[model samples]
Target: MAQPPKGTYEVIHQPNKLKDLVGGPARMDERLIAKAEAALADAVSKIDLAETAKDSIVKLDEAVERLQAEGAEPAGPERTIYTVMHDLRSQGASFGYPMVEKIATSMNRYLELGEPGQRGHNDADAIKAHVDALKAVVATKMKGEAGAIGQQIVAGLYKISRTKSK
Candidate 1:
């Protein structure tokens, strides 16, 4: 049966209309397709789980180095760093490292602050602080919301973010 919204369809299987719909036996049914999809999903999940997450942290560290090197250079390089920081901000929390995400978010804010005077210096020190924060979280294997130390670090970064560095 068709549902409302003009064009919505519910894909269902009707076994009785075997020879009429396709001129032969309906070889594929919803159950078969669903089972196949589930099996594929399971296989893909297994493959995805096999990769070591530590490698990701290593890569992120490398990216931080690149961002630091690009420090307050120009918009192009800074934009690349911004993209990296943005990704880290969104991905870290999902990967069980909320602290990294928090630090990344702060870094993103720092990056978005425009030029140096408006708190958007994008210097090595400012970038390093956030990157180091990420490394700390990963190394310590911290999970969930961070504790006082993390808060302190973030607060420090944010403080610098509000000031101009030129």
Candidate 2:
């Protein structure tokens, strides 16, 4: 068999084309959503809390502070902090501390995209925002604080990153 020219390939627009899949505004069962959210809250509340999360958060705060002092020079301490952040990202949700998970996830995402110890201001500020939020979450013992304020925190951080960060 002979190979075809590699200049181009066909474009499939079917996925992009909106073929009248809907004729009106989307509908959602608010009751179901509310009920599911209530169930999730209940389950999260029942989770066995890990005392170590608070201690780790304190350490995480210290690490972030060190990173701040370092000023965008990625190194051992920074990496350690990010690793801890990653752990929080995974464990917080499971331990009924979804705020921790959310803040950690956001911090991890920032670190993933924006390097520390370089272009330091935006990343530092954003990371601090997440850290501050996580501090609140951990200190508050994972209450219902992971609501609108969390989203607002992320949004503000995102804005800061977009405006000044690489």
Candidate 3:
């Protein structure tokens, strides 16, 4: 077979808007870090993690029920659960709830690995366990590992996930 002619492409470099805006790199001094930390603390304080997470967990529970009703198929509820879990994972750490982040991460992985409609009763139970864990975290306002209890909660969730039948 004759080889097709190679096409030549021109490379274009785009200007760095951020660099232009900031001018140059600045050292992260202690004072700057302190200021940033204070600002972050203030912003974090404004967020009611308990209320927010509880609301999301409620939605997650509803989605879980819908998913179970739909036989764990790919549908609006699955997407809703995934979205809620993702959002929880992202916000959990920032809000000082690392356990929430951990559980949500596990939930997301479960959703990702299991094929729609192929999930079984154990899978739904595992998901429910995740939801329960999240609820416990929010209800207790658990944050920053929560010591042995947090470790146990996360470990228990993993155990449930591992036991899920195909």
Highest TM-score against the true fold, candidate: 3
Candidate 3's residue-wise lDDT over 17-119, tens digit each? Answer: 9888899986779999999999999999898788877679889888778767744554566677778999999899888889999999988777776654446
lDDT of each candidate versus the true structure: 0.64, 0.66, 0.80
Native RMSD of candidate 1 (Å) = 9.9
lDDT (C-alpha) at residue 141 in model 1: 66
Error of 3 at 21 (Å): 5.5
- Top candidate, metric lDDT: 3
- Per-residue CA lDDT of model 2 for 83-131, tens digit only, reads 8888877777666666677677666666666454444543556667777
- Name the regions of candidate 3 deviating beyond 4 angstroms: 1-8, 15-34, 70-74, 115-122, 163-165
| Residue 5 of model 1, lDDT score | 70
Error (Å) of candidate 2 at residue 25 is 51
Would you list the clashing residue pairs of candidate 3? Answer: none
True-structure RMSD, every candidate: 9.9, 10.0, 3.9
Report the lDDT tens digits of candidate 1 across residue range 1-166: 7856777778888776656767866576899999998986676445421133455555555655655563434444456556766776666655556777777788778777674234333465777677677667767766667789878887888887667345
lDDT of 1: 0.64
List the candidate numbers ranked by TM-score, top first.
3, 2, 1
Which residue pairs collide in model 2, if any?
72-116, 72-117, 72-118, 73-117
Reference-based lDDT, residue 165, model 3: 48
TM-score of candidate 3 relative to the true fold: 0.76
Candidate 2, after superposition: displacement of residue 144 in Å?
Answer: 5.1
